[model samples]
Target: MLDFNRRLFLGLAAGGAAAARFGAARAAELRPHEKELYEAAKKEGQLTWYTGQYQAEPSEAIGRGFTTRFPGVEVNVVRSTSQVAFQRLSQDMRAGVAQCDVFSSTDHSHLAFLKQNERLMPYKPQNAAGLIKAAQQAADPDGYFQVTYLGLFLMGRRSDQVSEADAPKSWKELLDPKWRGKVAVGHPGYSGAITSWCLAMRKLYGWDYFKALEKNQPQIGRSSADPVTMLNAGERQIGAAIPSATTLLSISRGNPITMIYPTDGTLMVPAPSGALKNGPHPNAAKLFMEYMTSPAYYEATRPFFSESLRPEVPPPPGSRPLDEVTMITADPDELERDGQEVKELWRDTFGV
Candidate 1:
């Protein structure tokens, strides 16, 4: 297997390529609490946030807001895919670099990994109890690593090619012969969101469901964004368990797409945030984590159409309301333990 750190660097570079393509935006108007956190960041002098949330515009917007809030503190935002981010963070911890101070990614396993390594400290940000209870429970009892947000959805092209009623409403629906070559999915091995969804299936339907999915000859893409791209381009007619908002964002650009949370079930992934146990800048790291979990900082990224785990926050436009969707539950710890076995099973069935 490739070294996780190198892969992370490559993913970060790939995302940086996108950032270069889209100019960064200044922080959107700040609310009162955001202003206070911004001042705190300024006092800290520097903050670093490494994330797997790879949408370019939102990433830049986040960086810009941090910059705006803390003019004195330079925010170095490293954007990468979650697989690479998790591997790199693991390698960094082992190598003693811990380049990331505050780590936020869609991968809950990485959050579990950080916990096992004892690389995270407990900290309940000011408003800890308000977020989703499942997400809050995932955090350290004392509040070390908490879920920042989660993205749960299914999406496809808006073109009449696939009617809303015909869209895949359950995991089993993706395996229909009609979608044989038409189905596209983000790589389960590489994407936390995709993997989390798979894990949910394993927990809900058992290993047999995954075995069947693997046989479906699903086309797996390296970029988490590719399935949406393929659907928007009309290269594929259906995709499931992707970030629906991403598909909707394409729709806004006239790419012709629509999304729905499956009635049968949807897997909610807590995009987690944590502080390195021995980070280069501990205080700044804590400040950043505290700020991000805060509602003010949370809302700043909403325009990108992803869901925050906080219940008080609303789901983005064109996305199903959380309560309306059926959700499957999987213990993060159980998923972490069985993760490798799960990936191997995927390869065996899918021939990936």
Candidate 2:
């Protein structure tokens, strides 16, 4: 009877141990770099990342990369347009829900707004010193946000439809009678990139530039990436403001698309990432902030032709180097002042 009782007790104990191991999600086992943060994040077990930087497919890949690196931490990505993401974050805060741990948007002004409100947690990335000068300049001085990527609006077209000589090599060429009704552009209201591009163009040329372009009746879309599909489908002969990364990725896939770095200048979008101050998963969020600056993160982003913010990571193959391109970007203050005005103007002009 004694032996029977002992055996039964051991069996129960082992079953209990097994249940603890696999019955539910646990904290991720800490790594050398993330050890200090691992315990806290492990307890949290998951983080919600609100991203306006990438679409669903690429965002999921990034989340998977984070999970693969940290065994116990799961990344729940909320991907949407930059303005939409901002609106959602705003709504969540108003509702008193700490649902978002990290927020990344292509619009730089959002960082200033969040910081002004003390909504962002000040955390310097361990890899900040290794980033390029431009990327460094884009980061918040107090370390509330860091520029993770740089995407540009370049002229792109169907490779078969437009020969090299026939392609519009400058922004001025887009006004040619040839591309009228054949050019596609993203709406500023829906795309942050477009907002900046509109602001920059208005600064450089004035609202009259948009007025002239309006006469062409360009096909407008919501996402900056829309031009890639529209051009590939031969629905448009040219794109007025296609994202360089999307165009490069499409070309790599054998799509009949070719990107052009305009002789005049290209609109550069510096995407910023930040951790929420009152996040549900603070440790996980900070760890993610650090992870984004690591080479491994750049490696994961390479497949999608993401423009690298880290100096060590090379530009996506076949794309022009940043230094060689004339990239125009608006100051955060300028964005704050004129961003909404540009979007409202875009809607009025395009009527979409």
Candidate 3:
């Protein structure tokens, strides 16, 4: 017992020493302001992130990258679809548990709702200035939230099943009887990206558009990323509103799927991240908000084909720049006001 105690003590001491050295080494890589933030964050030790941005793989990769750059601070990533994440966050809030430090959601309305309820911490990240104009425009004027991620909600198809010449060229093409039962889509009630896409479609083609789409009997998944999986598996030949980044990531893996920028316009989904008002790790949350806007965050996400928030960073290869694309964007105000109505409309139309 004595020997065991001595060994355990030595092991713990060595681990502590290694952690100290790692933190010091990483701190050397930071700028003065970042170093200062890192010092405070290190004291907090970790931050819990509730994200509906990327799926688990890329989300966890970003978390790991942050830890590598800020050694003493760990990231606890809780990933889910937008509505689900929001529901979980709501549960935490109602329980008075400060479980989530940072909340990143694909639904802009979520941030607006949080800001309105005063549940979000108002903080302007210094690195936010480096964001591109579009991202800046999407940020909350009062700094309750900032756009941290961007993706195009576009169409895609299984190359093995659909020929380029025969594939859909516009959103309207999916409504044709020829593609009935072959269309895949995500549930707006579950995914914020899908909610935005629904709004964009409603704006463009009216509620009759979804009424027409429903006639074709589309397969509905919980998350926008699920369409990519369905397309890859040949479970669905065409994805009606797949996230461009997730589609590109699958394509890069040699999946037999091809992204198709709808001739009408691609919907650009701006995902925002904000610190929680009653988080356990406020300093760490602030540090994370800063990290999300930094170039390192872009670098970590670039390989996954996520659109860069900073102008200095280029889009991934094979991905078109936002300026070059005919993009459709939703207003946060509209989304905040009509999000629930759209969700209900979707449920009424699809019976899901």
Top of the candidates by lDDT? 3
Strongest candidate by TM-score: 3
| lDDT string, candidate 1, 1-352, tens digits | 1011223223223433433354332334655554676566566678667788656677778777655555676767887778777777777767868577888877777877777768886666765564545556566676768767666646464466877777776666776667767777786677777776667777667778766666666668854677887787677777767776577678778776776566566665556788877777766676677657655555677677765544444556666544455555455676688777777777777777
| Candidate 1: Cα lDDT at 155 | 49
Candidate 2 displacement at residue 241 in angstroms: 1.6
| lDDT digits (tens) for residues 1-352 of candidate 2 | 0011223223223433443343422224444667777667888899999998886778898999888887799999999888889999999989988899999998888878999999999998776665655566658989999988667788997879889998999887887777888999888887888888888778777888898898888888888888777988888989877888788888998998888888777777778999999998999998898778776677678788886655445556777655466666666778888999988887787777
- State the displacement of the C-alpha of residue 175, model 2, in Å, after optimal TM-score superposition: 1.7
Question: Which residue pairs show backbone clashes in model 2?
Answer: 27-42
| Stretches of model 3 off by over 4 angstroms after superposition | 1-28
TM-score of 2: 0.88
Clash number for candidate 1: 5
Ranking by TM-score: 3, 2, 1
TM-score of 1: 0.82
Q: Write the per-residue lDDT of candidate 3 for residues 159-267, one digit (tens) a residue.
A: 9999999999999899999899999999999999999888888888899999999999999999999988988888989998898888999999999998899888888
